[model samples]
Target: MAASMSVTFLDVGQGDATLVSADGHHVLIDGGQARDDAIVPLRRKGIQQLDLVVATHAHADHIGGLISVLEDKPVDTLWYNGDEHTTQTFEAFLDAALDSAARYVEPTRGRTKALGGLEVTALHPGGDTQGGHLHDRNIVVRVSQGACSAVITGDIETDGEHDILRSSIEVDADVLELGHHGSRTSTGQRWLEAVDPDYVVAQYSEGNHYGHPHGEVLERVERAGAEMLGTGAHGTIRMRCSGGEWQARTEAQGPVVAGDREAEAAPGAPAEEPPATEAEVGCIDLNEASPEALEQIVHIGSVRAEAIIDGRPWSSVSELDVIHGLGPARVGDIEEQGEACVR
Candidate 1:
């Protein structure tokens, strides 16, 4: 059989840059900052041409480097939410796409494309929905090669995850790129009960101004018994799903597994589900983060903030990062707002 697709979580600091390679084809999901630095990583992956590009949303951290990619190389199809967000950043992104003759496909439910071993479908952003909730309106992609499959959630927040769960679609997968930097807002309890990913990751910057991988959010991921690999601490997380076995490059403090977790018999989580909102959030809390937490939050995306708050108790006033969204910079900003705790 031919080779399987591999997913690489590029170390773009607090931003996101993922490359999916299958059967010698390339698919990029959210590039890094505007410096065009992600190209080196793509070259390392042996990417000759980009067959597909998925822009989760118009956030600069995700779309900035895309300018570089387009300027430097040729890409076939670009999948993105086409709403006129109108920010200078968003406009620049639009201008870049128009500069190229590549097709711009609006992200919608059931939009499917196949390139060699990679088969990807848009499973979220259904019609008859409000478009303003951009984070929740983020696209969710289902990709598979041979016996292994992965789902990429683009900045999808609690509302989006819960909505997908209530739908009649399927959320089964070997690996899941956590939405929104693991901000407690995106991965709500029901969302976890639904995805149940075997391997998970959060793409954030090291010593980021924001304390990412919220303590409670990390606990939630651990509670699901998923193997979590983060870019901030683990470097670039790489995973290959083939022949029902999964292998990943990790920097875990403990032992690591090189294959997929056997949750095979479990029902594929519901995908075409309805949306739900959050009860509380982590950014609202300030005491939980460590000193390393302060820098990462400056460019924290909105996806994870949606689920940052679960129905859990703050062990003490110290776990400030448990609240939704406020990572390092926000906490500092919050203190500037006269809420800095005696940490």
Candidate 2:
């Protein structure tokens, strides 16, 4: 029987943290900001030691909490990008890494390492990537266990994604940690096509200053036909794979088994088919549709439905951009879905 692999996307609030466990070995990736207490999840999971700890980049949001993790946990190896930063957080992380007993290795493109039952590979930041924007030089890692794999990108923008794509390393995976927290600057159309992940996770805080998980990114992910999960919305999300199959569970939506995403039929919609899951369902009149009907649209949820209702008498689908979080691209998705109409 093949062993099960579990990947937990921690809700670190406006930052990123993920833990991968397989065959009783654990790997920690890119602890969130210093105040996020990213180690708490580790403690909750009863993990006393980590087989490998990775610093995906020098950004504080990605490496700050790692200082504490390195100091407190017993780690066998540390993999980090060689990029240098002057922030106190980066210096503190360096001091902690040096102080720890773990061996340090500077990761390069196409370097693969073994940690228990998982094959961890570096897929970004080649030799030529030196001395560019930090986001462009971010280190990207892919973790594979059997036929199931996941790519965790740490704030890599389009340039970094292009670098990885240009390298042509096999990046197809079951899950993808959306780059740059789902910023429009990352997760380009070409990148999404290459990955073709079943699930794409965006790790950030709700109402964050940068408005992460941008609407354009959301539209693209929808267009790509991949389910999108967000830490800001679902809290901590855990994905498990066994026998070459994957399932996900989230704190907000318990027991989200594979191929069983929530589907609802709007009022007056046909009962035999759900508009949310069907390809050709009747569109709800946005001006006259109830909250429940409005919720059937691609991005409109309960809150957004209420907002749409309160801001009544829409002129066109493009007018949805006036509502918060409903950017032009996302509104376009709703229009493209043909689920919400102004009439």
Candidate 3:
């Protein structure tokens, strides 16, 4: 088989989990909040063993699901920033890491290694933690194969961005994983200018309480003339690169031309699945439905109903799978009942 590399920005609901594979060797960046959020996607890709695994930081949203991955899969090497954290999730991750078969390494800046056929360079956490904040202590890494490269920024804020810039690390890449879930605090003008990415992926949940990929950051990315894709609206974004060229595909939106700057589906592309009819509309349109209206569904309670309301503007009702604990059977039932509608 020709050497191929791909990255999957998993939609783990307000968390970050990316699977990077090059020529069949795999390295899991950050496992999201739930076990299936990480494992299901891995199993689907037919990845039973991980060559390397990285926990950028100790935050639950970043490393929570990694515990399950460590317990379930065979990982050869586990890399993490050596920042001390006391949260139960962090402690559990540590225990799992210690017990797993993987060799543990706390990588620092200026280190370079080969993962399968890809080259990886550590570009952040040059030294001790900054400002005593976990977000500031994030580990940044760049993965490259031939002319294609990607930078994975692990929830680092503006200060961390500056730190990377000051170190003169090569931040330029074809794909830039937006820092801090596209929070205004990251992806500053200078950083975007330096990267000049062809595409950017913001890993975040739709309708999350914390507004991510903030308006200002979006404007900055547009100004940089790079295509932006969010896990929130786009679902899982997959990029496959061979030679010097790459193409992106989404779970729902279909294939995305790598150089296309459009943030959403093409202008003439179908905007959404056909809307529920007036009779069906009597039940509820998920995008427009109120919490009270959603509660009328068979298994939907006040909490789930509110969650459904919060996760709005569904391009398809299938997005309900992003909601924790809502499986395909439940989603199918909801769709059949026609009680919870979608645009």
Candidate 4:
């Protein structure tokens, strides 16, 4: 088995940014809304150069941060879905890629590449994007190392999902980044069943006007018997694959065996001790603490931390309940240990 492959689903507030690293080679899937949204995490992870940078599609939320990355980091190659967009962000991204002097390749379906020990396969937009919805033309990529695999579905919708299913391609993966931020129009029952993922990560903003990761989509993910984690709730979900096994850990949730549908903690795993009370840790101003910092509060795991980050500038601790999974009990626990500092 290779040493380890790490996948980080960055919390980029209403957008998607994922980093995959194996054997010192790195690949960035998408960039969030702001430069720091992707840069800060990259710096924290000590990633100075990217083996490949993939702007799954030409959306601002997905390509905006890549402009900064291209300016700051030395990316060897760039990949896109071949969909054209007239937006300023997409244009700027293209200019940056050109300026960065990286090899630019618009991948097609069935194209595969080996990045160190990881195998990356392009699974979508097999052909032209002329007549289809933009979202349906997303560049879906499957990454695998040893026995663990993860599929990164950009903003693909139901039509794209069905197209992928009909193609002679494999959709099964241990971790599936839910399509279109878990919108009802995507992740259909048949699609989820076909993927049969063990874990699903949905990246969306809390209180998003769009109401992403809709209740219905959540229900479908549950019905698929897959453990779901939302970047809206969990700050950054990290999955590490090693020795033919994988484990997922969030800044708040510590570590859990990845792909375990039973949600069982690995043997000899530390007990699920409650976090430090707000009083002990001092009041965390919901608007000020970084997503990584918010994870320290009692009962505030990655998901809740992300929710708190999303619902920023809280007027009172009472407002915490608005975040999914925070509930009344969890809110009470947080209030006792910390104060919601709102200006």
Best by TM-score: 3
The predicted structure with the larger lDDT, 2 or 4, is 2
What is the C-alpha local distance difference test score of each model? 0.66, 0.79, 0.78, 0.76
Q: What does candidate 2's lDDT look like per residue over 41-95, in tens digits?
A: 6654446789889888898999998988998899999998777889999999999
Residue 283 of model 4: what lDDT?
A: 41
> TM-scores, in order shown?
0.72, 0.75, 0.76, 0.75
Candidate order by TM-score, decreasing, is 3, 2, 4, 1
TM-score of 3: 0.76
State candidate 4's TM-score: 0.75
Higher-lDDT candidate among 3 and 4? 3
Q: Ten residues in a row with the worst lDDT in model 4? A: 262-271
Residue 92's lDDT in candidate 2: 94
Best-matching candidate per lDDT: 2
Is 1 or 3 the stronger prediction by lDDT?
3
Candidate 2: where are CA atoms >4 Å away?
263-343
Writing each residue's lDDT as its tens digit, candidate 1 over 212-261 gives 76777777877888877777765556666557677665332212373444
Candidate 4, 138-245: lDDT as tens digits: 889998877778999989888888888888698898889988888888888888888888888888876688888888988887778777777765556777666656
RMSD of each: 17.8, 17.0, 12.9, 13.2
TM-score of 2: 0.75
